[model samples]
Target: MSGSWRAGLLAEGVSITVTAKAYRLLRAILMTATEDDKMLSRNPCWIKGADNERTPERPILTLAQVFELADRMADRRFKAMILLTTFASLRWGEVIALRRKDLDLTARTVRVREQLLELEGGEMRLCPPKSRAGKRTISIPSAIIPALADHLKRFVDEAEDSFVFLGKRGAFLRGGNFRREAKWAEALKEMGLTGLHFHDLRHTGNTLAAQSGASLADLKARMGHDSDRAALIYQHATRDADQKIADALSARVKAERKKARKKDH
Candidate 1:
């Protein structure tokens, strides 16, 4: 009915999840609020609207799709950045904050213990990661080692741990840099894929690892999910790998049946 009511329901554990009807109702309420609906002032539902958005069970990118996305981009630095985001599941802020010293080429690991954040007062600061477990060092995949090495050599300028992605000359790369987003969206559109979000790249890494038979405990540690239940979200959310595995089993069964028929002759 109202945003307060919906928010209260959610806050009180009345609904385990958002329903399609609830989503539509929330959307409609937002529209009405924009059109001067005084009854919905300070709507808490608006704050949590993103949680209502649907997410795929498996956000894995196929090997082909990963390579295809690479081939679409000419800027090696941008390509490398996107690849790191997809492969290492580095958050955007962490990527921007990365320094040369943070990477251990010998160990092939990237420590994500810090983040560069622009505070409310508009001062940029490099601080410890948001959560305690976020202070982890994850091993970088060997597939992109060369790409990252090249990126560090060519693109990154040493300004005393300043920034890896400098937007212009002295300005730090802000999230408002629309070129990357527009380019990604256009590329996805050209490839006939829809509903790709930047954060979904992290999901891509999680799903790929899970599909490749990595244990949930390992995935949890890599992804820095604090608990088993949080890790299960990755498993429960990604069903594409399950479908592909099932298809493979069915094909094997069909092949076995064909062999049996042939042997009967």
Candidate 2:
């Protein structure tokens, strides 16, 4: 039955993602029937890797590229948004949900208490983060503190409950509206960064943090990921970073040898 289902989906030319989701749904139903309902002697949906969705590689922008992208924003308000998103590894939902009180410029931290979720009918709702770890306070990089402060002064209202990022007409910003108003696609084209998603900003930030010799625990805390596996995926060591580690190890070994020789003498 699993083989037939796979064959039928392939014949229909369904996307890999859709196929994987469909297969998982089918497997889940069959598993329930076999175990809970006792309708089947054994489950037939035993396809390996059929339920796994292979995510495409997201582009990791360099620090220079990140700055360049921010500079190209036509709306001055969005400049700080881009910078904060990259440096702080904030998801779109979390960043948009930021309130004036959530940020502490003096302390250089952004407290993520909730996220703004856009519902099916385009209604915006504030809900708790996807995971407990998501409700965290991230330490902001000092380099972007000035930019964040500037954004608050210029765009955000003085009220603590006021949204940190608002639309030009002082309305709540939605994901679809943000893309249209920000001219996100055009900006990417101008920077020669075609096919880059907004989420890639978070990915870039995570990659940068990992490259900074962040321990697994540190990465998990900063990224607000619930699982070690998710944090491990972000630990992409660059060639330069790897070289620095090798050089440091070599120096330590050489110093130890020199000390040993001096003691013998």
Model 2 / residue 195 / CA error / Å: 0.9
Candidate 2: which stretches are off by over 4 Å?
A: 1-52, 236-265
Q: Which predicted model would earn the best TM-score?
A: 2
lDDT of 1 by residue, 197-226 (tens): 555667677777666677788878878767
Compose the digit string of candidate 2's lDDT tens values, residues 1-265: 8988775553332445788898999889999999999999998989888887895566889899999889888788899999999999988889999999999999999999999887766688999998999999999999999999899988888999999998888877876567778787788899888767777888899999888878889999888888998778766455456888999999999999999999999
Q: Give the lowest summed-lDDT range of ten residues in model 2.
A: 7-16
- The candidate 1 region of ten consecutive residues with least summed lDDT is 7-16
**Candidate 2: global Cα-lDDT?**
0.85
TM-score of 1: 0.71
The global Cα lDDT (0 to 1) of model 1 is 0.67
Error of 2 at 89 (Å): 0.5
